[model samples]
Target chain A: MTSDHDTPARPAGLPPYAIARQGRRARYDAASVHAILDAGLVAHVGFVADGRPMVIPMAYGRDGDTLFIHGATTTRIIRGVAEDVAEDVAKDVQVCLTVTLIDGIVAARSAFHHSVNYRSVVVHGAARHVTDPAEHDHALRVITEHLLPGRWDEVRPMLAKERKATGVLAVRIAAASAKIRTGGPVDDDADYALPVWAGVLPVTTAIGRPIDDGRVAEDTPPPPSLAAARRKFA
Target chain B: MTSDHDTPARPAGLPPYAIARQGRRARYDAASVHAILDAGLVAHVGFVADGRPMVIPMAYGRDGDTLFIHGATTTRIIRGVAEDVAEDVAKDVQVCLTVTLIDGIVAARSAFHHSVNYRSVVVHGAARHVTDPAEHDHALRVITEHLLPGRWDEVRPMLAKERKATGVLAVRIAAASAKIRTGGPVDDDADYALPVWAGVLPVTTAIGRPIDDGRVAEDTPPPPSLAAARRKFA
Candidate 1:
């Protein structure tokens, strides 16, 4: 569990545009969306660059209804948002951010019926280039702690230069939806009696042994934060 | 290793527009890009829908320079590509596809220096709806076999009705780039002397023991294909 300091309670509902048309597995409540967001480390961000679609994988953190993604200020996406902030017609950078966790692979009697058990959240939003000092600092903390829950407290405060060099985009989700698929594969009634063996092959992101940077004392152990992460992610 | 049957050789080079501007970690050769793509199961496909960007996670397979993504004909992305095929001026649907594999997390004394070791590939191309019977069949087999390698023979073949209901889009890659990051965190020289513990937390995707669908006899073991997958992914 994350330290509950600034962790806002999951915001209520999703916008109409964000509701899944294929409703069987759709989740509209903020809690459902937040759960998947918190569990993932990378988001695939889709945006229009030069009138063409572009997708980039990024490390992100969720704060209630908002998601923060950071990168160097000079990067293309960051620069695009900065320019959008100045444009008279465009007030914010539009993006579709999605995170997915693969839980299992479902094998069925027929190739057509094979499916996967996964949890994914898609957020459509107008993102702003974070400029306010307080919000910027908070976003950084959310990102740092999101990856290693307690690391923010163990590390020194952000440096002025470091803060300036990084860029944070805050995507206040205008619409969001989460889709989850679980359990065993559903096959055709006739195919069920076939000789084929079918089931789910579980998949997971495993946190392996940590290696020392070797700059520190050889015997020094990983900090409390990494230890906490080992337990949390596992 | 995948049971080699019709595995095409990696295509040659990337287009100029697809080449990474941030050249430090960019790989342009087909071999490097294919290695990451082949290792991945899902691709985040980015496309423009109704003048807005949309990102969807899809199962895809690669053959030489071509990538195939299949779905029901009614799906928005599939329909969009079909319409593009009919348009008088534009003959194909343009999209950006990306895949990522997280290898490890770098924990540093400073949060600013923290990073993750990952390998990712981005592909940009115009996709054509596959209407040829032979190509459609090949695409379906590729999609199925991509998930559980060597399982195509273990399952029943796709029926005619199933073929009629599915839409396969072939993206002949026009531009592509792969970026890879590895090893320990690079910290500020002065920060290395701090007493804080720093290291690399290794991460990996693990394939767990298979669970039976229970329709078959309980004693039946997972087929040889799943055994190969466990060894390959592990």
Candidate 2:
């Protein structure tokens, strides 16, 4: 239902890498891209490894246009970026990061036309290791709060030793695009006459009741923030 | 809890590409790999385009050890593979397919240790066009049933012309590995003493009420298969 007047202008120039094959589905507005990125719980990060493409799912968080991802310092991907810097081959790691939230399964009369209703954001950028202590701390807070709202304040602040072991990479989205498909299935006119049911089966990620860890004291109750999150998605 | 006696033997020898930096998290048994792939609703297919890694989310189905992915013949990924074949660069398209199901959000006492509980499968292999008519039809059936358990039988059979417009690729399970993390968060011993609520917030992909297309007859009820799916998730 997006009309030319209602659609937001593309703030970031639409780079060739971000163009969609189905031009109608491509969106370049910052609002559209950020919304998809915020809704997704995990991002699949694509990077070249030994001349082969490797895609790994990782939890991510965003602050403005910068997306933060972290892993153990010893992990292959983190170390790979470090090696790139040491060799001076590249200042940042080239990556294609994607986040997708599937909204429904679109069942059409014809199998060829069956599709899924989804919102996805694809970002192409060079990720560099975050060196500034202030930015690193803020990025960690963003990541922690993204998964658990109000968690950064509730939990103990990260110890210096723990910070040393974590590798944080910040990728300022150079070029980004959001592709969304919603509503009911779009089938061929001739196939609409077929005596078959066609519609959308909505899909959602629901959060179930919280389970306490064994170490928790019997008197200690679930935090209000945790309980609220469970209720929000329940 | 996985016991050494209960863990299945690794059927496919661990390929260098399948190994995880954290060795303890990697599982190579066919059972482990297949279970993760089955539970996931989408796969992120990684392929090289113009020497840059492109990761796109796709709906996929698994039959035995093989995975099938289909899209419109006009799609960029499909056409890219076709061009590769036409140029005689390689008979198959090199791809890294990944599927991930986020089971829960792990809220740890320290932000550095926060992680998601998930099961993921990564398959490194070459995908080639499924040109055989019988295999193409079977692959389509696998895809239909994978999304909606009994959908293939209830839907109208695909018309010849409909099939002609679809492009399907099959990737054999070569060098596949599964990585899983479950249970509550594991925090540092000192941090565990902090009075912070830390546990797993369970997550699941649930199906909501179906919305029928307006074109369907007023008396035409939702098929039994659709009803069954709703109940399964409910």
Candidate 3:
């Protein structure tokens, strides 16, 4: 589906880590990359701790070209980078956040040939602390709106003390790449004769029936955003 | 759904990181921790590079209590940990792997309070290189079978060169902990009167219609393992 008119305003370069599969290579364009990020709710953030690597999955949101992350103040990874003071231990470490969606399964006849069809975005940049109060507050709103649009205006904003207690960070998608795979399975010619069922098993995200909170007022109606997501998915 | 009859076989005393979460605090129980790990497919792994932390999502398998990970020889992270290598980089380092499943989206009346219902597992331990060829082969099979049961038998075995070119490493899951949050939206009593949705949007893993591989022989039948998984989820 890629065409000259489908390119995004932001140009997409190649991934630093590239692997070739002859016919299995994915086409990269701006629209394709943004779509993957928009459809995902969680991101796996990788960083170093004690001179070693670590990965953590957390919720994320994007504002234009920037991505925001929020977490507990007690988390060592966030606190270290924010305070710039290594607690009796090293801190101020660089981190990378990645989002990926498993679109389908590629069932190849040869075991070595089996692969998962997926869309993934990897952001490489320095993860510094957010010291500006206004910037921090807006970042939180961006995150909330990203998940539940229009809900930010409906709910109470964060308190000064509460905001201080939570750590929020932002990184631009300046140096990043997206990879994707779609379509039927690929099998070796000789193995095609072997009796086996091989094909993609599609996976999708759907919103389920809403479970009302026990304490909700007997007649209160759900907001349009909540109702709309449910009805659309249903 | 926790049962009083179930008990965990843990070491004599509670480890520092294995604390239990009762109320809003996170606590560690052996059975709950193991269950979270067993249910996960892959883990985000972290390590440090040039004063920065790098986290990569990778396939992993567990046996007894040890976690195994492998990668191509050319990967910087793997080569850094190689033994008798030209680089003076430490081959072993402290690493953590985390798995999380978001059960639902808890839409609280207050935007600042919005949170997801999730269960997560974190493992902390020292990673050691797997040097023995036999252990290396066994580890690779575990990784394959973990992703696809009965896959090890169907695929061609690894070649000698292939095994040598791949770096296999194992880490004991010690000082591990798990944290979980479940239930409907928890909103303040006053917020209940506000005209807003307060409930959960349940999320589930679903498999769709399977697409047959074009290259598969017409007479081929689906494997039992794949069929069984489909039925169980269906």
Report the candidate with higher DockQ, 2 versus 3. 2
The runs of at least 3 residues in candidate 1 whose Cα sits more than 4 Å from the true structure, single-residue gaps closed, are A1-22, A87-90, A218-220, B1-22, B87-90, B218-221
Candidate 2 per-residue lDDT over residues A1-234, each given as its tens digit:
111111111223344234433356778778899888877788998777766777888778898888998877765567778777754444787778889888888888877777888888778877888767888888888877767777788878878887777778898887777888888988888887878888989989988877867777676677776775665445
lDDT of each: 0.77, 0.74, 0.62
Error of 1 at B222 (Å): 2.6
TM-score, per-candidate, Cα-based: 0.90, 0.88, 0.81
Tell me the TM-score for chain B of model 3: 0.82
Name the top lDDT candidate.
1
Ten residues in sequence with the least summed lDDT for candidate 1 chain B: B1-10
Write candidate 2's Cα lDDT for B10-80 as tens digits: 22334423433335577877889887787777888877766677788888889987899887776556776
lDDT of 3 at B44: 64
TM-score, B chain, candidate 2?
0.85
- For residues B1-234, write the lDDT of model 1, one tens digit per residue: 000011111233445234444465677788988989888868888887766778878888898889998877776777766776653343677888898888988888898988888888888887788988999999887877777888888987889998898888888888787878888888888887777788888989999999987797666667887887777667
Tens-place lDDT digits, model 1, residues A1-234: 000011111222445234445455667778888888898878888888777888888888888778999887766678787876653343577788888888888888888888778888778887788988999999988888787888988776789999998889898887777778899988888897778889988999988888887898666667888877777678
lDDT over C-alpha atoms for residue A94 of model 1: 77
Q: If you score just chain A, what TM-score does every candidate get?
A: 0.88, 0.86, 0.80
Each candidate's number of clashing pairs is: 0, 0, 16
